[model samples]
Target: MSTENTGSLDTSLVAAAAGALAVMCASASFAGVLADAGWLIPALITVLAVVGVGVLGRRLGWPTVGVVAAQLAGLLVILTVLFASSSAILGVLPGPAAIAELARLLGGTGELIRTGVPPVPADPPLQALVCLGLGVVALLVDLIAVGIGTPAVTGLVLLCVFAIPASLADRMLPWWSFALGGAGYALLLAAAGHHRRWRRYEEPDRVAYALFGRTTAVVAGTAGVIAVLAGSVFTGVGTEGRLPGSVPEEFGGTDGIGLQPFTSLRGQLNRDRVVELFRVRGLQQDSYLRAMTLRKFDPRTGWQLDGLTQGVDANAPLPLPEGTTIGRGRPERIEVQPIGYRDPWLPVFGTPVSVSGMGRNWRYDPAAGIVFTQTNQETRPYTQQVIVPDPSPEELRAARGPMPIDPAYVDASGISPQVAELAQRLTADAPTEFDKAVAVNRFFTDPANGFRYDLTTAPSTGQDALSDFLFRGKRGFCEQYASSMAVLLRSLGIPSRVAIGFTAGYQDGTEQVITTEDAHAWVEAYFPGWGWQTFDPTPLSDGRTALPQFLDTALHPPQTPAPQPGQPRPGPVPGAPAPPVAGAQPDSRDVPQQRREPADRGWSITVLALIVLLACAGAATPLAIREIRRGQRLQAITEGREGAASTAWREVLDEVRDRGHQPRDTDTARQLADRLVTDHDLDATGADALKHLVTAVEREWYAPTAPSDGTLTDTLEAITRSLHHNAPLDLRSRLFPRSALPPWRTTP
Candidate 1:
């Protein structure tokens, strides 16, 4: 086989590989943000496939545009195979069904990106989304560095990738990720520089070339360090503050607030010190401390803090839930002192009748069944007179109908088919709605099902995630159990919502001290005769959970009417299932959770805007840099600096190169100027300017004692203006100047 100039194609693949390495390093920032690293596999495959397509197309003698098109098509096919093969034609090509499936997956990904806290589950949808983004990045790197031939600009694209995790991560990104990103960028620069050396210096001096190579490495390393430090400082990774702004509590008048109960609950529980959030006094019986109620269940997202309760005076008597009799509820007074917690929502026990000793900023929303404040949730002591409903087993058993006040309470639109079928199967023999609810709870807590409370399980809520939890990996924390049970109830045509708060904490003297470890979630099913009834499904081996009176009565009835003390708390109907745990604790390492403090909505939007701006800026960076360098060279000529004649000549050649003309290495200054005049069909002004520049350049090279030319800068500017006026395609040249890249050789 005859030798072919395949150097350009080889260099392109090298640069593409550097981009892949950089992206993988940046992906490490998501280690704790996502449940696992499974996304990396598909993303790696996507980048590799894109590079492979470019190499194949170039080897076949295709033009740059055709090569790029092939690369994009290859990306689509790879993604279809990985994520949407079921809907694809021949399980390879993307058809209409495949496109629709990809769109649906992206839609869910958008919702997750918009509302999710860090450490969201690494499900198939999320992996697909990640692969798509990184694939696009790879294509851009190939086109810009190899096709467009400006490898230096690829650094800006890499920065965009690194910024994502830096902005969203709950903790500081690992140090190795930053180091790898720097090394990858340096490798890319070194590769590009090496290619340029081979082309520019035919008989290169070893000492000079080595010095130039060292300078390039130093510059690349310095740029990388500066970028990482700037991003860290600007994103405020280790600080509790946002980017110098306050977000609206209502989040642009959106219906629901962002609540990451699973993330935050796990974080608190895993903390080294058990933080006391609230102290409950005057509690004659155990009850779950109500923090907030999430009434909306999105199949894409588990639970949402939907809609605001109508604001009423803090001291006013809150309206009772619908279907609740006013006098049937037994009244109880409880005093609560918030200690270390600061949130928009306040915690209260049972249904609030009235609240005392709180500021006017606090308001009760009876419909939503929680107390909230728009101003602040500063630590304060308050007293509440609330009613705890005591519905007997007979009343709950007779309860009929779904009884949905709002359709959201019973909306099961996006449930997985397998999950819906499983719900039907589990409750098939149950005679009543109450029995169906009990059966679902029992299925989870029953040891025969092999479900275990493990904090390390991925807390994903997608269809695939739900199937994995119920059918395969039956392990998770309170958030999983509560959300799963609530979705199951809705699938059975029952009204249900997930409640988040602290369980009745360990009793300490006269007060029940609720700690961070006590953060809990449970299902509340609305019965027709009664209101929302508590059902705990998480099986905690710990003794922190309290059995609700109604569930206890329904499961195991007393033999006599009179109450008996120390009855072993009705040991869960003799092997039916145990009462759920109070909350979750740490596994091996602490799972860093989304901060429970006020969400920095404005900060999030600002960071996203900055990332978009960086991408836009990256595209135009070469043009901007070329313009700046042009100005500096012209300024040096005007000041009569050394080498003014050579500077003027080189500037003219670069302008010629940008306008689609390449001056050969053997061409003299006079010969190049003549070609530019003839090719561009220059007018008298342009021809005269080129003649003046050519004379100065020849004198500078041949005559050592020649004086500096006074009119060199003016002549260069005149030629540039003439060139702009003559060439119709000068605008394209200005934006993507060909002179920014080194000349490359290719053979068909």
Candidate 2:
């Protein structure tokens, strides 16, 4: 092969590596969008495997179309091995089951992308999506840079990879990622230009190649340094203060700084990590901190906040609920400090009698039991003298007829008929509104009723959503439970609303620290004389949730049925107990068990090994077959079989073609010999061997004796040795020999 061809080969290899590196650098921008770095290793492996396949195909002299096909096949196998191994054959080859599994993963990832927030958990589906997406990107990079021989076009693919995280996150790309990607692109451009320079100079001088290489390195290094400095100035990755890209370890509602309970609640509860939102000092009892309340229910939108309610100045004493008087019950004073929380509505422990140390913009909505401001909650602490009234079951049952609250609170419009009927049936025997509320709560929290807390369901509201939750699914987190129970209460003509806030968080030292994981939603039923009272129907799997004192059976025992004369007293009704359920207030020292299904660890490792093994084997199969074929031809010549001289000449042609030199179809034996000697600059031994081979080829065709020589193998070896000496074969040429493939499979 000529020096120019060699330089082109070298450039292709360099471009392949550069493309892979560039892809990885771009993928690093996802750090700002994923909750964790778990997706990185899988994505990197996928890109490398795809690029490796393309490089191998090009080396083997396969056509661009063939290389692309091989890359796509390899990508599929890799994904199968990594994500759908259990569904594949021997965990290496993709089967029908594997395809189905892949489709399922794709669907799951698409759903998460649509419904989840940025920094969503890096689950298996998301990781699979990242791997699949980056694998295609790597294939594109290789096809453009190596197959089409254009490295510059790969910038578009790299940009697309970086754009995903940039669009999802409200911040600039990480500086290091930008710098590394810039460096990769610079190296690609420099390497791509190297071959053109060699072609222009028309020289095979070692000094020229060395000089060009050194110059390219210097240019790439200088560009990389400039990129680093520029990125640092613009992105602010490691700055002390918060920047646009530096998202805090906090959770917000659906809309920025405002609680949109239905979707916001799901996002917070499903967060990958817990973040402290507030710290409370002097909390007297377990209470649900109120931020806002949703009273408007629409079939299409589910539960929404009562947007028309106005508030009075929070600095002055707040009025109590209508027709309610301050009892002699002792009031608790508390101070709440916003830690990492960002929301317009302030968190208050209970119905506030007086609030102090807040800005003038902060207002108190007595109807909603919410303290609010038009702006975000200040980090500064605020004091509240709040009252949580303890009403007896009899008092609560008697205070029910109708409250003076807005009629909309009890409006049951748009509720599904199935949900309404189900609620009526569950509470048919109950005599009072409080009993009906308790019956509804038991229907959800009761394990016997099959209501399990699950976060996998997508957030939705309306009559259909309620029907799904209450009748068919029977599984959901706090949002579903709260919305369903509130609507069910309204169906029974009781004034109720869904309250959004934090649960009574676990005590840390002297402070009650409320975390984003503690964010919750529950029902509040209004009694005629008393204010809105709390009722939690959600069966939380986590043990941090505390039951209200009114629901504690130890304080107020529920009535049990009498036993018959002949039979023993029946055991306590399953799922009917108010408190002391499996998920209610476990010992604080106990570790909470995660509700997510555990991954199949042993199966995963086995499949991963299979995938890597299969990918390596696929790359090596062509080279292995080529070697076997070469051995058979050389054996025929050694045995002096029929047409041994022709076999020797044919082998010589393949060897030359394998090394990037293609002989013309019209060239005669003598002409081919002359061209090989002059082009390769073969030594005396190779020249003599080539002369003999050309004479033998002519003799084999023209001479009637059918020429055969015992030394044919030796002569062919000499010519091959000379060819190697003139332009030594490298590992790449040996592995991806173009002559091993059919003419149609190669560029010729």
Candidate 2 deviant stretches above 4 angstroms: 1-270, 322-328, 400-402, 458-463, 554-748
Tell me the tens digit of each residue's lDDT in model 2 across 464-484.
666766655665667778888
Per-model TM against the reference: 0.44, 0.44
In model 1, which runs have C-alpha deviations exceeding 4 angstroms?
Answer: 1-270, 400-404, 458-463, 557-748
Question: Model 2 reaches what TM-score against the true structure?
Answer: 0.44
Worst 10 residues of 2 by lDDT: 237-246
Q: What's the CA error at residue 616 for candidate 1, in Å?
A: 21
RMSD in order of candidates: 18.6, 17.0
Error of 2 at 740 (Å): 62
lDDT of each: 0.69, 0.68
- Kindly list the per-residue Cα lDDT of model 1 for residues 1-748, writing each as its tens digit: 2245332234444545665665666566566457678888888899889878987887788999999999999999999999999999999999999989988987787656544545568888889888888888888877765655555667767777776666655445667667767766666655543333233222235323432455445655665574567456434532222211133233333221113433323323334446677888888798898777787766544576776655576677777765454336678999988765545566887877888886667777765677776542233688989888787766787876545477778889888888898888877767778878888888776666677776656444543656666765677777778888998899998888888888888889999998877888888898875788899888777765676887866555456444478654443232233333234322332333422433434465466547655664765576546654565576578678988988888888888878777788777788888889899988899999999988888888898588878887668767876886786444456456777666655331
